[model samples]
Target chain A: MERILISGPADPRLDDFRDLNHSDSRPDLPGGKGLVVAEGPLVVGRLLESRFPVRAIVGFKNKLDSFFASFQAENSGVDLSGIPIYEVTRETLATVAGFDMHRGLLATADRVVEDSVASVLEGARTVVVLEGVGDHENIGSMFRNAAGMGVDAILFGNGCADPLYRRVVRVSMGHVLRLPFAHLEGSYTTWQRSLEELSQAGFHLVSLTPDPAAVHLEDALKGRDKVALLVGAEGPGLTEHAMRATDVRARIPMAPGTDSLNLATSAAIAFYERDRSQRT
Target chain B: MERILISGPADPRLDDFRDLNHSDSRPDLPGGKGLVVAEGPLVVGRLLESRFPVRAIVGFKNKLDSFFASFQAENSGVDLSGIPIYEVTRETLATVAGFDMHRGLLATADRVVEDSVASVLEGARTVVVLEGVGDHENIGSMFRNAAGMGVDAILFGNGCADPLYRRVVRVSMGHVLRLPFAHLEGSYTTWQRSLEELSQAGFHLVSLTPDPAAVHLEDALKGRDKVALLVGAEGPGLTEHAMRATDVRARIPMAPGTDSLNLATSAAIAFYERDRSQRT
Candidate 1:
């Protein structure tokens, strides 16, 4: 690996780490040169393990060495001979990242290709389908919950944010890179058809709703085998069409008059319920 | 009731509703005019029902009238006869509140006298005790979860946030007003003494932790009647003294690699488990 030392703020090679507050949003722009940037050591480690092509890692010398040691130990075949581990003082590092606290490490990698819906569902027993979950933090949190709660994959329907967006990645605690997810293409009809395909493949399509009339989650998932839990944005929950298409509409029995739980928390409970039932 | 039509933002009576962004934070400052503000119709209704002494309501004329009509129908004896209901266009109301979105309504009330820890715990079956939970949003969500999941009251230990803070109240969906909570004074010694009092009162104090060796929450709460579930902040968790002070240390059964669930979410799940076990 080419281990370079970054001393000053205006180094041309550190362009990938500049003006991160604003330019980070326009990852899809022309000449965007958008790299999957991971902040903090824990997330940086996940980025290194991910299939995305690692470009370079920049951190304090000691932190960079520790990261490299762990990276080499984990991946025996990882050829870091050409990769540069840039070491700079804490002040210089913060200036380069345009943040006061960088958590001692940052890494940039080429964005990986998103999987197709079919590819994500190839051998999955459980999946979470999201609709209109535009908030980046919520999307990231859902992915993290999905990963932790044993969901096989995530399927994004209409009006969802980019799962690879930096905020989403950060909020997901790097689970976005680990979890298998794909955007569902086509119109609402196509999305419905995709859900039908999952149903045909022996998946139980369950729509999570706050409707008082829906079956309680515990009762609904009591004996289900393959389940696809569908969730929507917090305020305007699942659309009527989507609710109608599911085999079961379930609710996390809530106290009367309270607003619904945050979208990700709701999804987490549902996923927890599903996992709990399977264990029982 | 005096129906005031305040078309201009400069009206002296509207001072309580002015520059709400900053005034709401430092409610104790001179000329601060601290008021318990409720946003949106649902929370406004809750604010009206709560014990807080409501001063007045400011909202769109249509929504304000509807609120008053509902209060009248409920025969709430809300003492609105002397209170003013400021009627304004949504735009003007938003301007007075220093925001473009006002959620169509607001209610202002004098802060109620908080219950003492002993008072809040009077005749309580299940309670939640928090420590070092200084974040308002987390505190608010905890209250919302506590109310929804059938917790009797919340007792704040050392280093807790004010439950009546606007963000906490808003995030809690006004449940902060409905749910009983009291702060403990003095040091960790005093907080420990309070826990001991709960124990003497026949309450089983269960401290929640992420330690793998701890008993599972479901197993721990199996037959406990009066239980006080102790929760701490997200990262550091409960202090060692708090953990030792409890009768038992319990843990939510989580997926192997995940750190821990959000503080409020974990508390909700624990509360849900207790409710479920008790009902069954």
Candidate 2:
């Protein structure tokens, strides 16, 4: 990687890293260059390994060196000849970022086209389908949990947030960059029809709800070859139509008065149960 | 309940809520009133049902009216005659809260004494033991999970944050006020001694870790009559000393190369698995 020395925050070459917190979330910015921004070495490393195309990087020399070392460790063979890593003073880096980035480094990647639901679902055993889960942190944590629990892909129905958003990337610890996700086909009403593909692919669509009449999550997944756990926002769970589409209305039984768990935690439990059921 | 009409935000009675976002996190504030703040109708309703002694209530007339109606519906039979419900305009409520509490309602309650570790463990089928889980939001979510999953109590080992802090209270959705919890007796080294009591009470101490060599989470809990699912913070999972204190180190299996799950989500999974094991 070539080291492009930076004197201050104003260099045009460093525009990809400037006020980065603003750029990643706003797709309507100039030229629609809303690059997917990954912060720190941990997330930036994931960004490098992801399908997203790297634009450039800004960091102190030490972090840049370690990133290269980690790349060498992975032996990813990703060509670095054209990727310029701009080295700057810590002060200049923070000023450019508009926040004191303790990680002292960042990288920007041009957003790639999202994969289709079918491509993400290829050969998958379990996937988590989300609806109305528009919170960035919730989406991020859901991706992180989905990755750890070995769910194959994540598909969004209606009212889902952009997974590539900067906060989502940071909160997911970069797992959002690694996890395969796609928005479900069609609008909310027709969204149910799109799930027909998963059903055709032999997925047992399990919609998680707070209804006591629903089967326990464990029993609901029993003997299913492939499963898609559908979850919704915290206050208002899956819409009536969304719930009606699922093969099973499943629940993690709760004490009498408590409301539903936070959407991510609920999804994590469902994912864990899915993994346990398959293994056992 | 007496409905007191407050003219503005400056009333001395409203000081409990003034600059609340700052005061709740700062225990050293003058007068030393660390009041438990319940914002929003959902949480305020939980507060009305909890054991915390309500100091007073403040909100617009509509929300206040609904709260009394809810109190009557619950039919707690507790005398509400002495508790004054203060009424104010939206502007006054915002000024009093230092920022608009979109919850449109607020209630103050005196902080109650915590239960002893022994009392918390009594009759607990499962309890979540947290160490170095200092983040307020994590603490709150842990409480919520523990409560919903029917985990009898939460016992903090060390380096944990105040569960009653405002952000925690808000994040837990008022579960902090309802759940029973205690800081383990004594300091870090001596805290291990408290585990002896749980052992004597027939509780299995299962420490959660990221080590793949450990038993899978489900396998680790089989045949255990009562369980304490111990979890540490996100990074630097349970200290070696903490891990060694458990009867077994258990892991929620992860995909290759992922770090530990978020502390609250990790504990929630364990609680869910524990719920599953107990039933089937």
Candidate 3:
């Protein structure tokens, strides 16, 4: 990594790191360059190790130095011959970013072409299919939980948010960068039909619902060879069209009169149950 | 409920709902009245159903009218004759609250004395004991998940945040108000010693950790009659003293190289597994 001393917040070299708090013009937003951003040293390290092409790194000198040393120690073989590591003071970094980034560091990566649903499903035993989960934090937590729980891929259905969005990356602890995810392509009304491909790939599509009539999650997943847990947004769960396409409707057996679990937590329980069932 | 029309934000009757966004002087914060606030209609309804004594209600006319109608419909025998429901325009409500409360309504309640840990554990078949889980969002999610998963109570150990914090109340979707919880009375270093009481009450104290060597959660929780799941903060898990005091440390077998699941998600998974174990 080449260390470059950058003094002014207005430097042309820092454009990728500028005005990040601006909703419309932030480099990572859709209206801007549509780049991916990883905040904090831990997430930035994950970005460095991911397949995405890194553009630049900007941070306070001391934070960058410690991060680089630990990153190299963990990944000795990483070749960063051309990546510019911009070393700036706290004031310059905060001014350039248009906010006090308490995390103190950020890295930008160009978004790569995503995988196809079938491509992401390859060599997978457990996967998560999301519908209408537009919240960044929920999507990020989904990726993190999926990675931790050993779910192999994530397929986004209708009304899902961009998985590469900056906050999603930060909230997922950068697991969104490492995890395999692909958007299911089609119109909103017809996108669920693509789920049949998952069925053809020998997946037991389990729609997670709060309906008491649904089978318990453990029983639904007990002996399945390959499972795809379908989750939806918090307030309105999976659409009837989406649920009808799945093989079975399963639930976590929540207490009566209580609201359903948060979407990510619900998916995580399914993932955990899927793993537990396999182990036994 | 007496529906009183308040035209001015400066009216003294709105004191309990004033300056809600200020960190120091918010009615719910330590420097102010230390009252419990319930935002949104559903949460306010929960507050009405809870044991917390209602102080006042303030909201826009339409939101308040519909909420009160449904609340009364749901609880036919409950009396609200003495509670004052302040009717104000959107601007007045926003001005009084010091923020644009998108939820459109708020309710103030006097903080009731919390139950003792021994009393909360009296008939609890499943409970969660939290340690050092200081984040408000995580604590709120813990309560919500505990309620949905049928956990009977929550016991707060050392370093935990107040469960009645405004953000916790909102995030828990009012479950924090409905769920029975108690603070474990002890100094920071000696709190883990209180685990003996749980054991004496015939409850299995299971500490949830990410350590690979620990028993799998399913195996650890299977066949336990009464279970108390111990959860800690995100990064540094349970302190050694806390884990040392438990009967067994259990793990949700995670994929290698990934970070542990979020604290609340981990507890929810444990709760799900505990329920699954007892069914068979």
Q: Judged by lDDT, which candidate is best?
A: 3
Model 1 chain B worst lDDT run, 10 consecutive residues = B22-31
**Greater-TM-score candidate between 1 and 2:** 2
lDDT of 2 by residue, B186-227 (tens): 676667677778788888899999888999999999878999
Highest-TM-score candidate: 3
Question: What TM-score do all the candidates reach, one by one?
Answer: 0.89, 0.95, 0.96
Model 3: lDDT of residue B280? 92
Clashes of 3: 0
Model 3: per-residue Cα lDDT over B1-280, one tens digit each: 5799998998999988888854323355465777789999989999988999998888888899899878898898777879999998888878888888877889999988779888898888998999999899999999999999899999989999878888999999999999999988677789988888888999999999999999999889988999999998889989999999899999999999999999989999998888778889
In TM-score terms, candidate 3 sits at 0.96
Candidate 2 per-residue C-alpha lDDT over A1-280 given as tens digits, one digit per residue, 9 for 90 to 100? 5689999988888888777667786577564456798888888888878888888888888888887787767865666668778999888888887888778778899887889888998989899888888899999988889998899899999888878889999999999989888988777777877888889999999999989999999999887899999998878888988888889999999987786798889999998888888887
Cα interface RMSD of each candidate: 1.9, 0.8, 0.5
Ranking by lDDT: 3, 2, 1
RMSD of each: 3.2, 2.0, 1.9
**Local accuracy of candidate 1 as per-residue lDDT tens digits, B1-280:** 7788987777778776777765555457765666778887878878888899877788887888787777677755555667678888877767778887457788788886678877888899999999999899889888887887778899989988767777887999899989888876658556766687788888999999888899988778998889999999889999998899898999877776765777877887787778767865
Off by over 4 Å in 3: A22-30, B22-30
Docking quality class, candidate 1: acceptable
Cα lDDT listed for each candidate: 0.81, 0.85, 0.88
Sorting all predicted structures by DockQ, with the top scorer first, yields 3, 2, 1
Query: Which segments of model 2 are wrong by more than 4 Å?
Result: A26-32, B25-32
After TM-score superposition, the amount by which residue A273's alpha carbon in candidate 1 deviates from its true location, in angstroms, is 1.5
